[model samples]
Target chain A: MEIISFASAVAGLGILGIIFGTGLAYASVKFAVEEDPKKIEIDEALPGANCGACGFAGCSSYAEAVAKGEEGIDSCPVGGEELIEKIADIMGVAASSSDEKKTAKVLCQGGNQETFNKAEYQGVPSCQAASMVDNFKSCQYGCLGFGDCAAVCDFDAIVMNDNGLPEIDPDKCAECGVCVTECPRSLIEIVSSNEDVITNCKSALKGKEVKVVCEKGCFGCTICAKKCPVDAIEMEDNLPVVDTEGCIGCGVCVKNCPTDAFVEVDF
Target chain B: MQELFLLFMAASITNNFVLMQFLGICPFLGVSKEVPTAFSMGLATTFVMVTSAVVTWLVETVILVPLGIEYLQYIAFILVISSFVQLTELFVKKVSPPLYKALGIFLPLITTNCAILGLALLISMEGYGFIQSAVFGLGAGVGFTIAIVLMAGIRERLEFADVPKPLKGAPITLLVAGIMALAFTGLAM
Candidate 1:
C-alpha cells in the first residue's frame, strides 16, 4: 500500500510539473517583447556607471533613450570619446566631435590655516546645513570643510584633506558632476582635465575685503589678467576667469597672483 | 457571504501580511522607499498572490487531496508560485516596456516572497473554496499595499526631518515600523 501511494505521489507531481512547464514555455514565446537590438548594443558600449550624468537614471536607460533617438549620442560625459563613437556606430549616426574629457576641480585653496571660522558649527556636518546659518565661517564663498562633496561622490574621487578641504583625484573622477552640485558655495567646477590653469578662489569680494576673510581669497586684483601672455584671463564680476581655449597653460599667472589664487593643476 | 467577508477581513486586517504577520518584509522595506515604486510592487505582488491562490487551490483539490499526497503541498506550492511569477513577468514585459523598466528587479523578487507561499498554504489548510481563497489572496495583497505605501509616505517625510544621529536611517525606519505594528494591533480590538 505504501509503495503504491508513493508512486502515485511521484506521478501526480511529475504530471503537474509537466503541465506548468509546458504552459510557461508557450507563454514565454507568446508574450515575448520585441526590443531594439541596437539598445542592447549601445548599452554594452556604455561605461555602465549609472552615474546619472546624462540626466537618465543609469547607462541602460540612457542607452534605451539613445536607441529610440530620444537622447543625443554624446549625452554621457563619463563615456568620453571612444564609447560615444562606439554607441554612434551602433546607432548608425555620426558621432559628434564635441565630447570633452572633464574632471571635477575644487576652486578653493583656503584650508585650516588659510581660512578661519567665525562660529563653531555643532549641528549636522553637512555643508548645506552649515551654510544655511550666516557666518559659519568668515569667508562667505569658501569651502565649508564639511565634506559634502566627498559624501556625494560615488567614484571616491573627492577626499577631505586634513586641512578641512576637499581634494579631488583627477584619475578617479568620472566627471559625473555630483560633487559639483553638492558644494554649497559652488566651489567645485567641471573643467577640461587637460587644462592646467585653474583659478583657486571663488570669492567675489574686492581686494581688501577678501584679505580680511581668507588669506587665499582671490582679491580680483587683475594681476593674473595682466600677467597672462596669451591674454587668456579676463576679470568678470570681480573674479578672474581663465579662457581655457586661449590659455597656453604657462605658469605665468600662477606666479603673478599675490594671494596665490591662480593655480596650475598637475596631471 | 459571511464566510467570505470574514476570510477577507482576516487576510487584509486582523492577520495583515506585512504589518501584523510580517511575512514579506524584504520588499516591504526595500521597495517602500518611493511611493510609486512601492505601489507598483504591491500591485505586482497582488497579481501574483491571487493567481497563485487560484492555481494552488486547483492543484490541491484536483491532485493532492485525491491522491492523499498532502505532504507534497509545500514543494508543489513553491514550484507553482515561482513558475507563475516567471510567467507573469514575461507577460508584463511583453505588454508594457515602461512598466517592465519601472518594476526592474522587484518583479522577479516576488518569487521568494513567503507571503505568497503562506497564502497558498493557508487556503489549503483552511479548506477554503476557490472563490474564498481568491478573495483572501486579494485581501492580503491590499493589506500589504496599504502597509508598504504608508511606510513609504512616512519615510519620504523622514527625509526632511532632523532625525537624531544614532537613530537615523535603518534605525529610524525600524522604529517607525514597530510603531506602525503597534497601531495596527489596535484594529484587533
Candidate 2:
C-alpha cells in the first residue's frame, strides 16, 4: 500500500509540474515586455549608492531614467566623473567636460572653548530641536556641536572633533549636500575643493555682538573686503562674500582679517 | 446565495487570514510600511490567491481524488500556487510596469505565502463548491488587503508621532498590530 501510494504521489506531482511548466513557458513568451538593454549596462556602471542625490530612489531607477533619456548623464553627484564617462560610453553619448569637484566645508570654527552656552539643553541632541529654543546657546548663528550634519552624512566624511565641532574630510566627502541641508545654522557649504580661500565663519552679527558669545565668531569687520586688491570681497548684511571668479587665491584677505576669519584650506 | 454570503463574511471578517488565523504575517509587517505600496502588494496577493484557489480546487477534485493521490495535496498545491504567481507576475509586469515596480519583491513572495495554500486546503477540507471556493479566496484576499492597508495607515501616522525612545521602531509597529488585531476582533461580533 505504501509503495503504491508513493508511486501515485510521484506521478500526480510530475503531471502537475509538466502542466504548470508548460503554462509558465507559454506565459513568459506571451507576456514578454520590451526592456531597453542599455538600462542594464547603465545600471551596472552606476555606483549603486542609492543615495538619492540625483532625486531618484536608487541607482537602478536612475539608470532606467537615464536609459529612457529622461535624466542626463550628469544627474548622479556621488558617482563623480569616471562613472559619468563610463555611462556616456555605454549610451554612446558625448560626456560633458568634468566639472570642478566640490566638497563640504565647515564654516564655523567655534569649538568648546571658543563658544559659550546660555542654558543647558538637556532634550534631544538634535540641532533642529535645539535651534527651536533661543536659550540653548549664546551664539544663535554658530555650530551647535550637536553633530546633526555628521549623523546625516552617509559618506562618513564628517566627524565631530574632540572640541565638539564637525570637521569634514575633503577626500572622503561625496558633496551629496545632505550635510549642507542638515545644518540648522547653515554653517556647512559645498565649495570648490581647489579653492584655497574660505571664510571660516557664517555669522552676520557685528563685531561687538559676536565677541560677547563666541570668541571664534566672525565680527564682520570688513577688513578682508577692504584689503582685497581685486575687489573680490563684498560686504553684504555685515558678512564678506568672496567672488570666486574675481578672486585670484591671494592671501591678502587671510592676513588682513582682524579676527582671522579668512582661512586658507590646503587641497 | 445565503451560504455564499456567510462564507465570504467568515473568510473576510470573522476568520480573517491575516488578523484572525495569523497567516502571511511576513508581508503583513514587511509591506505595511506605506499605504500605496501596501495596497499594491495586497492587490497582487489577491490576484494570486483567487487564481490559485480556482486552479488548486480543479486539481484536487479532478486529478488528486480520482487518482487516489490525496496525500500529495501539499506539494501539488504549492506547485500550482507558485506557478500561478509567476504567471501573474509576468502578466502584470508586461501590462503595467509602474504597478510591477510598486509591487516589487512582494509579488514573488506571494508564492510562499501560507495564506494562499491555507485557503486552498481549507476549501477542499470544507467541501466548498467551485463558486464558493472562489468567493472564499476573494474574501480572504480582501481581508488581507484591509488588514495591511490599515496597518500601513497607522504606521504612516506613527512616523510623525513623538514616540518614546524604547518603543520607537519595530516594537511600536508590532504593538500597533496587536492593538489592531484587538480592534478587528470587534468585527467578529
Candidate 3:
C-alpha cells in the first residue's frame, strides 16, 4: 500500500509538470509577436547602458525608434560616433557627417596654484556643500575644486589633479553633459573636440579685483575679442564667449591673451 | 453573503498583504514610484492572484486531497502559478501591446511575487471553499493595490519637498513606508 501511494505521488507531479509545460509551449507560439530584425541588430550594437542620454526610455526603445527612422543614429551621446557608424551599417544608411564628436571643457583655470582662499571650508567636502557654505575661494565665480564634476562623471573621464581643477580626459569623455549640470558654479561647457580657443575664466570682476583673487582670471582685457580676424570672440560681462560657427580653428586668440586665459585644446 | 463580505473586509484591510502581512514589499516599493505604473502593476497582480487562486484550489481538491499527497502542495502551487503568469504574459503581449509595455518587466515578475503564493497557501491552510478562496484572492489584490497607489502618490509629492541629502532616495522612501504601515494599523482597529 505504501509503495503504491509513493508511485502515485511521483506520477501525479510528473503529469502536472507535463500538462503545464505543454500548455505554455502552445500559448507562447500562438501569442508570438513580430519584432524588427534591424531593431534587434541595432540594440545589440548599442552600448546598452540605457542611460536615457538619447531621450528614450532605454537602449531597446531607442533601437526601436532608430529602426523605424523616428530618431537619428547620432542621438545616443553615450555611444558616441563609433556606435553611430555601427548602427548606420546595420540600417544600411550613411551616418550623419555634420555631427561632430563632442567633449566637455572646464571653463575655469582657478586651481589652487592660481587662486587665493577666502576661508577654510570645514563643512562637506562636496562642491555643492562647499558652495552652500561660505564658499572658501576668494574668486566666488571660480571652480569650487571640491571635485563634484569628477565625482559625477559616469565614464571616469574627469579627474581632480593636484592643482585642484578637474582634468577632463577628452578621449574617455562621451559628452553626456552630466558634469555640465553637476557643477555648482556652472563652470563647465560642452564644446567640439576640434575647436581650440577657450577663455578659461568666468569672473565678472574688473581686472584689479580679479588680480586680487586669481592669477589667471580673464579680467575684461578684450585683447582676444579685438584681435579675432572673424570677430568670433565677444567680451560679455568681462569674459570671452566664442561663437563656434563664426570661429576658425586658429591659435590667434591663444597667442594674444596676456594672462593665458585662452587655452589651445589639442583634439 | 455577510460571511463573504466579512472575509473580504478582513483580507483587504485587517489582514493586508503588503502592510499588515508584508508579503509583496518588493513591488510595493519598486513599482510605487509613479501612480500610473503602480496602478497597472496592482491590476496585473490582482488578475493573476484571482485566477491562480481558482486554479490552485481545483488542483488541491481534485488531485492532492484524493491522492493524500498534500506534502507536494508547495511544489504544485508554484508550478501552477508560474505557468499561469507565463500564459498571461503571452496573451497580454498579443492582445494589448500598450499594457505589456506599461507593465514592462513587472508582468513576468508577478511569478516570483510571494503574495500570490501566500494567498494560495493560506487558502489551503484555512480550507476555504472555491468561492471563499476567490473572494480572498480578490481582496488581497485590492489591498496590495491600495497600499502601492497610496505610496506612489506620497512619493510623487516627496520629489518637490526639501529633503535632506542623506535622507534622500531610498532612506526617505523607507521612512515613508514605515509611517504608512503605522497608519494602516489604525484600519485594524
Ranking by TM-score: 1, 2, 3
Comparison by TM-score, 1 against 2, better one: 1
Per-residue lDDT for B73 in model 1?
90
Interface RMSD of 2: 7.7
Chain B structural similarity as TM-score, candidate 2: 0.93
How many pairs collide in each candidate, listed in order? 0, 0, 0
Question: Per-prediction TM-score of chain B?
Answer: 0.93, 0.93, 0.94
Steric clash pairs (candidate 2): none
Q: Please, what is the whole-model Cα lDDT of each candidate in the order they appear?
A: 0.83, 0.82, 0.85
Worst 10 residues of 2 chain A by lDDT: A49-58
Report the C-alpha lDDT of model 1 over B22-134, residue by residue, as the tens digit.
Answer: 88876676667778867877887788888899999998899988988989999888888888777777877788878777764355667777788988988888888989989
Best candidate (score: lDDT) = 3
**DockQ-based class of model 1:** acceptable
- Model 1 backbone overlap count: 0
Best by DockQ: 1
Taking the tens digit of each residue's C-alpha lDDT, what string does model 2 give over A179-236? 9998888989988846758888877787799899888777888889889999999988
- Candidate achieving higher TM-score, 2 or 3: 2
lDDT of 3 by residue, B1-189 (tens): 999998998888887899889888766766677888778778888888899999999999998888889999999999988888878878888888987786543555577788989999999999999999999999999989898899989999998999999997668878998898888888884
